[model samples]
Structures are given as structure tokens and as C-alpha cells.
Target: MVMKAPVADARNGSVVDRLVGIDLARGLAVFGMYAAHLGPDPGEGGLVGFLMELTHGRPSALFAVLAGFSILLITGRKAPKSGIAGRQAIARVAIRALVLLALGSILGCLGTQVEVILEYYGICFLLVLPLHRLSAYQLGLIAAATALVLPQVRSSLLSVAPNLLDPVFNLMVNGYYPAVTWVPFLIAGMAIARLNLNTLAAHWRLGLAGVALAVLGHGGSLLALSSRALTETSLWWSDVDGAFEPSKSSFIVKSSWIAAPHSETTLSIVGSTGCAMIILAACMLAVDALPRLRKLVWPIIAVGSMSLTAYVLH
Candidate 1:
């Protein structure tokens, strides 16, 4: 699982080695998505259900974050500033986006229950193109702003958008994995790539930061949920007839501050982003601490290496 120290190429001095740990993380994400899609629903409450809940929104966020990392690798680990090379890199990304959009459209036509992410992913790629030159700190700021602000913007937009065009509105805001809310994951990944992830200390810091974010997000949500201001009315209560009704409401009230898993709320975004960071940090640590295990998991790494193909085929 450990990455070989980045070997400098004599001709370019650029580090030319793959981080097997990243691939391993991607492999896990792919498997999580599989469990989410193909595995039978472990209906609401039990160890199995709890595990499913943990995996619910986080895997896709992990994939999105990895997409940003891959984008950086493809475009050159360092910023290109502005030149023929930069222009060419951008062109390649645009073409890839188009291909993803086409593939997603084709897949979407099959009417499978699985919500397609490729098209939205393509849009996210385009969205970050102009900001590619930003430093990691700038990107982090943007990510934070996007996570904090975009959900509220989406909520406002949702209320005003025409019901006749609800489908389109949903894709942009209300649907499973809306682009506006998901883009932050990509930005955060790009920021992480700029950091010194090879060191154990860096990984430890990232893990601790992730834990803090998760606690803040989830704790804030819990506090909001329990407040008398929110509980004074029946609005917070379950209104459905079924025993297995989802505990979290799909509807987003203006005053609602509680995070609901997969609800696309601001707290949900922050919490999921934290979960993603923790997973990546854990993967990095595992590889660094147990390099020998990499060979045993080579197949998983191979699957991750060709993740796009694997995702499409699955």
C-alpha cells in the first residue's frame, strides 16, 4: 500500500510514480458504490443499515474528490500558469468532459435505478477550469465558500424554478448529487493535492482536521434538531404512514439547519466532505504503514487504475 518515494526523472526532474494508496482508496469507493447500487437494501436500522447509511453519500463524494486529484495529475501536478501547454491541457479536459457527458446520457437512457454521476461530473470539470490556476489556499477558500453558500442558493433557486422544468432544476439542485453542492469536493481534493501528503505528519493533520469538521457538522445539526425553536411545531415530526419511512425529510425548510444524510443540505455537504477527507487520510496512512500489503491488494489497485471503465461497466 505504501507509495514508492517519488522518483525524479533525469530528463524532467518531475516526480514520475503512481501513489498506490490513492488507487486503493478509489477501489474502496468503487466497491462502496457497488454495495450502494447492487446490494440489497439493508432496510432502516441495524448494523447493516447503519453501515449502509455511512456509505450512502460519502462514496460518491470520495469519487468526486478523486476526480479533482486525477484532473491535477492529468493537467500537470504544478500549475501551468498560462501558455500553449495550459491551453492544450484545458482542451483535453473539455474533451474528456464531453465524452463523460455522452456516456452518462447513454447510460441514463437505460432507466436503471442508479443515478448517473458522469454528466454532472463533466459539468463540474468545466466549472473548475477557470480556477485551475489558483493556489491551493485559494482553492480551499473557494471550496469552503461553495460548501457553505451553494446549498442556500440552491434552496432559493428550487423554490422559484418553474415546476414544469422541475427535472432540469432537480439536476442542478434537488436531484441526487447536484453539481452545485458536489463541486466543493472537487475543489477540496485539488487543495489536498497541493499539500505534502507523502509525510505521515501531513496525513495525521489532515485526519484530525477531518475529524473536527465531522464533529462540527454533525454536532451542529444535532443541536439544531433538538432546539425548542424547531421542535415547537409538528413540522419536525414524521408525517408518513409507513414504518420504514426515512427518518430524514426530503423537503428543505428555510429554517431547517439539521444535517440529513443524502439530503444535499449544507451540513450534509460539510459532513460528507469530512468523511471523504478521513477516508483519504486513512488510505494514505494504511499504505505508508503497511507497504507489503500493496501486493496483496494489487487487483484492487488495478480496478482503481481503470476506475472510469469499471464505473461504466458496473
Candidate 2:
């Protein structure tokens, strides 16, 4: 599934594996963020604008999922590390979380239009620490449960939490990328990483799963809307076009069926995740089907390899 990255001997004896598909996916996420943050408004760019609109919320979900996969890669590839190795892995992750939190907080103070997700990611990393060692089936089940359950839980908590917790908790609950719904993406990533993704069968299976999920999410939203006697007129249009409308920035979720970007609604999460899976599977399959394609897309692969740097600098 992934090529082992070469590493010079470190005193601690840690080595990292690199997957081209994952890198390619991360690179795309970085560019998607660019499109979302820097490209022309969806209504302005025409087709390109539409593509930009599509990147609105899905890229963040992709990034979060990859983060989970990378977390699994770091702790242990196919199995959990034990004893001294395990302790060291825990320490590395904890330190990384703290650093991200501090960096995110500093960025948050800059009053930028873009929502800072690093703090949320840091929190997610901490939360995932205990579950990193879980088997694929276990993580998959948890991911499914979270995808279905956490959105309602988050909604309930928000309804009651005008004075319950601190500012960070608010960010984790209702901010741009709330951990409550977003964590499922990570869990899904970890679960996928636990399996042997190198096989053709795996790729096909993942792709089918992706298609099913995408349909489930988008189709479910449509079905729910129709069943409730709600039509297109009741909902807002243009996720990208809406960026300019400050009043629309804070959306009012009329029901659970609304699958708007950044809503953290169940359908929203599922749709974003399905898109992520489809993209990732496609990338891996592409490289495998045409090895030369890998060399041609070296720039993207390189960008993906250093995603964090690419992210912050851009």
C-alpha cells in the first residue's frame, strides 16, 4: 500500500513511512484550501468558480482524515507499538498537539477571515491518543457511530452551552471545523490505514464504499428534505457565493437534514468524507495504473510531502 520512506538513523530509532497517494491527497487539500481561501468567488470564476465552491468544506475534512491516517502511521503502521516505543509515540503526539494549539491560538488572534483549524486539530490529536491502537473494525465502528451520533450531541450541547465551558471548548463544539463531527473523519482515516490498502481489491472496495457514502449523504439529505415538505426555496444556495454574505455566515439549521458546509450536520460530514475517500482512492489507483504518472505529478507529490509547510506559507 505505501512505500517505506528512507530515513537516516535517529537515536530514538523511529522511521516514517510515506504513501504517494496520501501525499497526493494532502497536496490537493492544500490547493483546495488555496482555492477556498484565495481563488475567485464561485459566482465569478464560472466553472473554475464552481470547482472552488466544491472545495469549500470538503478539503478540511480530507485534511482531518489524512491527519488521522498519519497519526496511525506514526504510532505504528499495522500494529500498535508497545512498552518503550509506545511511550515515545505518546510523547511525540502530545508535544505535537501542544505546539499546534499554541500556533493555532496565535494565528486566531490575527483577526483573519479564514477560520483557524490547528487548535481543533490539536484537540483531536489529544482525543485520538487513546484510540490510536484500535483495530480497523473497532475504529470503523466508532467512526460510524460518531458520524451518526455526534452531530446531534453537538447540537444539543450547543443549545445548552451559552455558559457551560471555556472558549476552546466552544471552538471544538461550534467553530468552523468542530471536533465533534470532524473527529469521525479522522477515525475513518485511521481505520482505513489499518487495512492493507495496497491491493487492487482494497482500492475498488474503498471506492465503492465512497460512492455508497456519497449517495447516502447527498441522497439522504434530498430524501429528508422532500419528506419534510421542505424544498430548495427554504434553503440557502451557493456555499462559495455565500462567503461574501456576512449575514449568512452564521447559518440557521432549520433541521438535521440540512447538509450545508461547515454545518457539522451528519449528512454534511458523510458527504465530505465520501468525497475524500473517492479522491484518495482515485489518486492511489492512478499512480498504480500508470507508474509514469507518478513522476509527472512529482510537484504535487512534493507539495503533499511537506503539507504543513505548504499550508502555513500559503
**Backbone Cα, N, C clashes tallied per candidate:** 1, 1
Model 2 regions more than 4 Å off: 1-16, 162-165, 229-252
Let me know the TM-score candidate 1 reaches against the reference structure.
Answer: 0.86
**How would you encode candidate 1's per-residue C-alpha lDDT over 35-134 as one tens digit per residue?**
7788655456578765665566678888888888777766765554357877887898889888998898899999998999898888888887677777
Q: For residues 1-314, write the lDDT of model 2, one tens digit per residue.
A: 44334543366577645778888888988898888888777767678877777887888889998999888887886998889999898888889889888888888898888888889998898888799889999999999999999999998988888465677767678677887778999999999889889787788888889988888887777777677664342222225444323365343453667665786778878877888899988888877777888889878888888887787676
Q: Which parts of model 1 are misplaced by more than 4 Å? A: 1-16, 162-168, 228-256
For this target, which candidate reaches the highest lDDT against the unseen true structure? Answer: 2
